[model samples]
Target: MSVPQAKSPPKAFDADSAQRALRLARETLQIEANALIALDQRLADGDHSIVQAVQLLLNCHGRVVVSGIGKSGHIARKIAATLASTGTPALFVHPAEAAHGDLGMITAHDVFIAISNSGEASELMSIGPIIKRMGAKLIAMTGNADSSLGELADVHLNTRVDKEACPLNLAPTASTTAALAMGDALAVAVLDARGFREEDFARSHPGGALGRRLLTHVRDVMRSGADIPAVSADTSLSAALEEITKKGMAMTAIVDVDGRVLGVFTDGDLRRLIEHVQDFTKLSIADVMHANPRTIEPQRLAVDAVAMMEEFRINQLLVADADGILVGALHIHDLTRAKVI
Candidate 1:
């Protein structure tokens, strides 16, 4: 690996120009914010376009095909991803590419959303008629409701902004922000209407933290079988200590003939026992064990076990079956290693 050298900013872009830069940034944000605010207010004025668009999307039996050209293409791809993650099946296709061969990806059951701020993208305009003729619902998101693309659409979403955030007003700044916000609004509305939930989202993102919390069960991360440190209730304290050390759990479960949990003796209990008793060579495991210890079921989520541990301030927990039989054990390290803590 090579270390890179640090360099100073150019004289033209030094601290002297920071105030101008900050002013431009704040003005850009305010302009974009105002555009979103205007959009929200417009939607509240008995707008049938948005409602009709949502209805078509919710009723779509096939995927939602989102297409755009140039800068709008970037926004369209992100919208498609957001929709897909939030329970609506969607995909992005380049307008130019769709005219070549990707149009086959669309079907009669689909709802095709075309995004173009100016509503005048030549590529999208070229195929707008064909998409509608093929029976797919055409939705146009544009700054101009009267533009060719919007006029051809079954539903036209007005993503108009008073002006661009760019100083020259040529760049698609506020318009693109408005389009992005509108897409987010659609996704959220669809997500709510479909009754999408955290668990559903977690299923789609199984490798994420929420998935690990919801999908991982106690049985999936506990120490089971011979790996458990356990002993008979009448076993000597010395033998219980040996079992705890051999299993390397710093604790031992005191069980009966059927392995039903009678009590638990851990290192914490041993330290307390030493203060109360002088010689414990003759003491049975049951005499010094903590009875009726906090236990979790094997079927519970690992995250639930973590909550139980935190609530009780216990570092170790026992897993019991319906019959009160000790099935397994867990140490805080187990949860940590499983990334559930």
Candidate 2:
């Protein structure tokens, strides 16, 4: 058997060389920055076509159909997802599919967003007339305004870049980045124009942690009823500790005969009381408990409870209503377990 050739040794890292590499990266970033700034200037040139298109799109009764191919397709899909997630109803459709039967997805009241770096994607050309004939507005995003798609569009947003970040100066590097950024800007602009709120966004992402944090009310995760570790104000500290231990909570609530909450006695309070009085059996829970403990309403958000805990530097809290009645109890771990922390 022929002997295998020795593998090349790994290159050693030099701090000076690393600094030079970072400097080069910083320099390349300026090129993309300048491209975006130039795009801003072009938009500011007041051609008004893209702005008018956006205004019309915002008024659209149907979905926004975003179509593109290759690298542009990826950016268009992201833009579509962003718009739909925010407030606008939008979806991505491949131009190649439009040439088949997917063109039927477009409606007269919808808006079409087409992406083509060279503005001459042949696949998009066949679907352009179909969208127009359907009375749908066409918004073109391209690097060249003079290309066929740009010329035919009702509005053309220029994404012209000075040069590609690639060493060959031919790859879709800077141009694609610029197009994606412009797409985000448009999506956010429309989102803001439509008055999209956090609650609206949460609706789009209900299964996500953000939605859980926003949509979950205090009652959803609070321990309520008999699960609440509560004791009458006349109860002894030893009895409160028993309730706390039985409930597996570090604290117990001091309540009135009407079940209304009066105060709370925490492990911290027990520690302090232990330092002064060795006899917990003789101490009443009312004497050792902290009167007027911070409480939350059942309708309050678990996120708000976390903020309160952080602000108060406390780990446990009682849930009560306007009548000061003990309805539930919440611990910091509760929020953590709910992934609201």
Candidate 3:
């Protein structure tokens, strides 16, 4: 039997090959970035195609039905998601699926966004007549303005790219980037036109950190009732320290008999007092407290409280009611724990 030689494991690795690979990747990225810049210039030159597309979707009483094939289909799916998340109701309907039975999803009141790089995708072209017959308005996003799908559209958005980033010019690279950028532009314009606020976005995304920042009120995360570290102005320094220690907060609030906040005594004050006063135990909390400390209302958003804390260079704030009565308290750690920061 001839001795079989294991073909020397194909050059396990090559430093030169790795460097070439990185260079190619960087070049491709630069090309795609340049394509986006070109698209931006086209839009800035008074191209009303993007604005028209937004108006079409805005005026539609029904959902935005996005359809495309192949790579364009992938871009259509992403655009649909962006539109839906940002307040416009949208969903993707694959062109091939529409040819079968998904066409039932389209209605006269709906607005159709058909994406095709060449404006000649067979599946999209096949549905063009049926979409028109249904009386739905068709908006075409394509590189070829005179192609079949473009001719069939009520409005056309030209997503033409000067060149593809692919070395062979056969892959969808720059064109796809331009389409994505156009989709983003459409979504943002509609978002602004509809007056979509951060709170509205938070309502749609209640499980995310942004939702917590926009939706959580100061009272929701503040320590209230007995958990608040509070002491009377006449309270001895030792007793105030006990209140802070028992409450597990680094500070204590000095309040009047009516529960109105007079000032705050914090760990920083304790440190300063230790450095200056030889008999801290004999002093009252009023002597060591900082008067008119930063405060927020219970109804204020937690994110606003975080801003106040940052602006005032403090870690905690007292939550006061309309009458300036201390109802609760919050620390920077509270916002951190709530993921509002």
Top model number, lDDT: 1
Candidates ranked by lDDT = 1, 3, 2
User: Candidate 3 regions off by >4 Å?
Assistant: 1-23, 41-47
Among all candidates shown, the one with the greatest TM-score: 1
Model 2, 22-136: lDDT tens digits are 8868867887888888888877887566567679778899999998999899999998999889888999999998889998888999999999989989999888988898899
Instruction: Single out the weakest 10-residue window by summed lDDT for candidate 1.
Output: 7-16
Cα deviation in Å at residue 132, candidate 3?
1.7
**Count of clashes, each model:** 0, 0, 0
TM-score of each: 0.94, 0.91, 0.89
In Å, residue 203's CA in model 3 sits off its true spot by: 2.8
Judged by lDDT against the true structure, how good is candidate 1? 0.93
> Model 1: C-alpha RMSD to truth?
4.6
What stretches of model 2 exceed 4 Å from their correct place?
A: 1-27
Better of 1 and 3 by TM-score: 1
- CA displacement after TM-score superposition, residue 160 of candidate 1 (Å): 0.8
Candidate 3 has its poorest 10 consecutive residues by lDDT at 5-14
- Per-residue lDDT tens digits for candidate 1, residues 1-341, read 98888897667876759988999999999999999999998888866688888999999999999989988999999999999998999999998988999889989999999999989999999989999999999999999999999999999999999999999999999999999999998899889889999989988888999889988999999999999999998899998999999999999999989989989999999998889899989899998888988899999999999999999888899999989999999999999999887
